[model samples]
Target: MEVHAHTHTPRKKWTHYFWEFLMLFLAVFCGFLAEYQLEHKIEKDKEKQYIHGLLEDLHEDTGTLSETINEFDGHLKRNDTLIKLLTSDAIKEHGSDLYYLGRRASRSVRLALHDFTIQQMKSSGGFRLIRNQKVSKAIIEYYNRTVFIDYLNGIESNESDEYRKMAIDIFHPVTFNGIVNPDNTIARPENNPPLLTYDSKTLLRLAGMVSYIRNTKQGLMKAEIEMKMAAIELIQLIKAEYHLN
Candidate 1:
């Protein structure tokens, strides 16, 4: 019987293990770098999209603000005319003019704020996407001012309610409606109705309403003017920053 000695395989050298570890580390590091680059690109694209949308909103707000300013200016003039007529004795003789002016005097100018992009930024926590600090701050301030302006507008609405109540006492509703056309233009009533007749008591009430309106008009003017200025400033800033035409 012959016994053969078992030969054991040689162990791997330390250099071999080291090379294996180095290859694994390099592969993992390269994969991490690739993933980081991809995420960075995606974030950049998202930021541009947000900026473009914000620009559109700003443009719309600017245009609307211009129109609002014109509308409010017209209302202001009407308010002034109504105040003068209601405070003086002339309103008693020319009461027909009051019928035409009452509705215009109480008309509130509503602001059309284009806030869709800003709302999205707030809800999505995407404000950080705007890398420009000035742009971000301007955007925040513009929206914040809108809240105050809206509060002022609510005051105008309350004043309008009061004006309407006073009008009910001073003007005949059927006669007033007759003067206003369906398209909101002034037209003589179909029946060629007589002018509205009011007593001293109604005149006193109308005089008080005129005083309230005179005081309220100043506040409305202040708020509307400030909002318009703010919108213009923000529009300019956004256009400059984004290089928009």
Candidate 2:
């Protein structure tokens, strides 16, 4: 066997190695930047989606609150009328009118807050995605107020319950039935409200009912006003933060 001389290839220069390293580093850096941009875009989109959902919820809440406010205003007026009638001698002759007034006052208008979006944010810990600190704070404050409103609503419901109990004690069930026909129309039967006047005990019950209605009405009115103001403020904040009209 003949021995051949082996020629070894030259090692790469350091500059060559450095250029290769630089190229690899540049490529990786570009890819990382692209990925970061994509992630940022996704986060921004998610934030906007949350904001839009919150806007819808706030709008719904405001609308419902307006309707509820109007309904409670009517309730307040009816209760006021009942209070006046109860204090007058005419109530002895027209006890049927008290039935109408009591029926209105006894109704509880539950204000349902639109909290689907907020609840989701809270449960999922998505509130961190909101970049605007003001928006986050406003949302928190609004929900907090809602909690108070709910407590007030509970008190109002209790008052309404008491009023209903008073109604059961003072008015005959059969007589109340006489006020509404089977067709659901307003009607006054001859035997409606079998009694026209209340004794001392019943009058005392009426007085208590009137006092409760007044207190409930006042508390509800204040709560409604505050709720409306909060809603309006939140709406404005959302609009400003989201650049919405």
| Model 2 TM | 0.85
Candidate 1 residue lDDT tens string, 105-129? 6766677778888888889988888
Clashes of each: 0, 0
Q: lDDT tens string, model 2, 48-95? A: 899999989888988988988887787777777777766666666666
Task: Show the lowest summed lDDT stretch of 10 residues, model 1.
Answer: 188-197
Evaluate all candidate structures by whole-model CA lDDT and list the values in order. 0.74, 0.78
Which one wins on lDDT? 2
Best by TM-score: 2
Candidate 2 residues lying further than 4 Å off, grouped into runs, are: 178-192
Query: Residue 88, candidate 1: how far off, in angstroms?
Result: 2.4
Model 1 alpha-carbon drift over 4 Å, by segment? 1-7, 184-197, 214-217, 239-245
